[model samples]
Target chain A: MSKYVMKNLSDIEIIESVKRGNTADYTMIVDRYKDRAFNLLKRMLKNDMDAEEALQDSFLKAFRYLNQFREEASFSTWFYRIVYNTALSVIASKKRKIEKEMTSLEDMPELISYDREIYATVENPKDYLMRLIDKLPIKNALVLILYYIDGLSLNEISLVMDISLVNAKVLLHRSRNILRDLLLKHNYQEEIL
Target chain B: MNIDELLNDYIDGSINANKINELKELLEKDEMTAKKLKALKAIDVLMRTIDYEKAPRDFSEKFAAYLAKNRVIKKDRKDFVTPTVLSLFMVVMLCILAVSFYYSYLSINDTEMISGILLDIFNGVSFIAGNKLFHLLGASVSFIALTILYIMNETHRRFRKKIKDL
Candidate 1:
């Protein structure tokens, strides 16, 4: 079956199909999530090759143990858990810490508040924001991106990150504080109405 | 609490009208508070604008092949594990039964029978081990050792090649 035809199927329907011997439908699940999952894994691993390997490994592992998946949580959360864990294992094996460099004072922009409208009309807002977010610590970056960009709720974010709701909230709060501080330090403050 | 916390609470919409009024009052009074709110709003807007990374054009094709291969491996693993586990369980159960039978026989006052049975079993085992069976076991063990060494050597060579390629 064409993946586009399967695209309209809910996750449960696809899963049920795969379970009931329509094994090719598994590719639909993979196709549906590949980009979003790739982006997340890329951010987490911070290396394209590592992210690709981890993503592939995670998907394979998820398929291998699909029977163990409970319906209590959304498939995205469950699948993200697999990806998060797979990336972590690679990190652990590499024995290298994901370092967070404090943004240097020299790289700081001038201390004038840019008009909100002006910032909004910039050539590429998404690229601009991703660059700023990339400067934060991985923990903060992941939380902010997952919460704001990926549109995951606090509960889902906690599940995906294997953290408590309180921790997720705290991380989010701290990330915003850090981003704001970074902006202020760089004089990239936006004008408030 | 702190202004940052308050601002965050406000932006998250976790604050009620009273709290919102207080925040608005702070924003109106403190230029810094207003700027901070704007900075946060920018963050929100910018974040939502970010796009998901596009998967490679051939990702679906490659991933489907990977999944197909993975399924075969999974099937093989399942086939292997079930029989292996059943065999192990049977072996364990037989050992337990033999031990129980031995103990129950011991509970009897017949030390001679027990000794006779044990000697017979030992003789039978020794006869087998002393004959062609011993030679066959030695050959099999040596073969296994050679196979392991070959595998290890190949693995080491592959590892070195990989590092060199890198």
Candidate 2:
């Protein structure tokens, strides 16, 4: 099928076509997920090339194991799991520790003072917000990206991150609290509107 | 619920009218709580509205090219079936050879069917064991089988490496 026609087909339909030996149709799945999944990886890995490489590996894995995909599950959730795990493995390879092991909502860390001057370096408010998000722990960063950026639900985020739903919520709320603290310290309160 | 959860519920639009009125009452009286809510709301606005970063252009095309280049032959249970059946056949032949060797060398021949079977089996075993030409042929076949197995193993390992490398 042409890319234009393929664009309208559901992910499952595209998967079925690919399963029937229409390997060319896999581009739809790739194109559908590449950017959102890349955003997740890029935020977690903090590098474009690494994110791109991990994205490629993830797609290859998803294709290789496409037959193993369960029909009952959403392809976005399944593919995000691959992307999340791939990014984790990349971080593991680099020997960087994933921060914030706190699992409960009540386990939030004490608020620390943030440098207002640090937030002054970025003039674009969006980039500055992204920078604040980048400073979070890997899984915490991931939960935020998957939630706010990708618009995945907490349930789906939990599945992708292999954590409990409450844990996913905890990660998200904790990261948000941190980001808020940073913004407030930076005196962006009036400008946020 | 406490003020924080109430605030979250209010921000999420998950609160009932009763709780929302209660949060509003608390916001009027609570300055610290109000600041937290303000900051949290700002985060919600930015997080919801910010554009997601895009992957490089041509990502899908590059992936399609990579997929086309590496035509991955999926590993299936059927791939192992042939080897398993061949191994079973080889074991059966070895058992027949052992019986023939026992009958011809140990003098234990009894049944008419077995005696007839061993007569041909003895000839083939002796022919290979005694003649240099057949011996060379047997050695060459063994070498070729081992080489094939080795190459199969090496190919599997390299295919795995290639997948990981990319």
Candidate 3:
């Protein structure tokens, strides 16, 4: 893996390059982070088109405000924070705009495959597991995804999500319990034993 | 710890080895705890097995376009400061002019009144313009010093706003 892919350049380096108007350096940043950022946003938004749009918006916002990036954190971590917030904002706006429309899992093509696996594993299928996870509050879902799927440490998640480390740990715990209970209720027992 | 807390740490491999050993011992003694652990392990396996998809093919291209557009807008806004700085410079010049007039009024002899006034205005304008020019040049030289301070303050404000939004 490229050093840029595995480890981010120092925030100071990025800020210096940006200040010098070496915008091409930012392209290196984009190339390095776009995949992880896209995956994160895709999971958060649970929709391909929405995730794409939000990722674009987030990258634009990050670039526009690149000067504001402080040297207190790694560039990739800080950039992911922007991506997370942008995805949340996009999802919230979408929810408000389409209040009456039925939120079918199938509507989000990227999520459909996950829903299928979840459905295949549980007796209750669509009604129990998929719906349970889907109905989880956005913050809980985010915490779960960041902690579990992304393999980010609680401290890292806290920094990215701008929450206290204690809160991040608590949310991760609660989300796991919720998922466990939902899976149990759906009779996903075969996988358990 | 409780099963809920352990479950997250266990799945993430963050739980200490001591805790894991303790949990394993408890699972041996308590069937319900064992069942819960089993379920959690299964869920973790399934989650891991699921493929983590990448973004669409054109995502980088679209993102590049978006970044370019936003960069232009940001540059325009940053450049917009030149006019404001000029206005501030004018304000400081006016203040110096006023001060010079006041001092000249007290210092000038009666016979040299007209010449003194012209001299006062000329000296005041030169002093003010010269001071400001030197300050601006100094600012440009140590650009990182004041620029970092200003950017830090603005970034702080933005961070607070972002937290509030969350």
Number of the top-ranking candidate, with TM-score as the measure = 2
Off by over 4 Å in 3: A1-15, A95-135, A185-193, B10-21, B49-51, B67-166
Q: Cα miss at A159, model 3 (Å)?
A: 2.2
Which of the predicted structures, 2 or 3, would earn the higher TM-score when compared with the native?
2
Count clashing residue pairs per candidate. Answer: 1, 0, 0
The TM-score, computed over Cα atoms with residue i paired to residue i, of candidate 2 is 0.70
The best candidate in terms of DockQ:
2
In candidate 2, what fraction of native interface contacts survive? 0.66
Question: Model 3, A1-193: lDDT tens per residue?
Answer: 3865435665566568766766656666666667777777776777888877787777777877776776777776788799988986886787743222113333334444554566665564323343545555567666666665566778989999898998887777666665665566545756444
Backbone clashes counted, model 3: 0
Off by over 4 Å in 1: A1-5, A98-125, A186-193, B70-166
DockQ metric for all predictions: 0.26, 0.29, 0.21
Better of 1 and 3 by lDDT: 1
In the range B1-166, model 2's lDDT, one tens digit per residue, is 7776676666667789998788888989988778878877877887898876899998987887777677663323345777899999999999999999887766644587677877999998887788998878889999999999999999998997568545
- Pick by lDDT: 2 or 3, better one: 2
**For model 1, which pairs clash?**
A111-A187
For candidate 1, lDDT tens digit of each residue in B1-166?
7888889888888888888888888989998888778887777666777788776778888877876675543331234786899999999999999999899876878888878989999998899888997889989999999999999989998996567445
Residue-level lDDT tens digits of model 3 in B8-105? 67777888889999878887888877666666776666554443457777766666676566555344235468689999999999999999989977
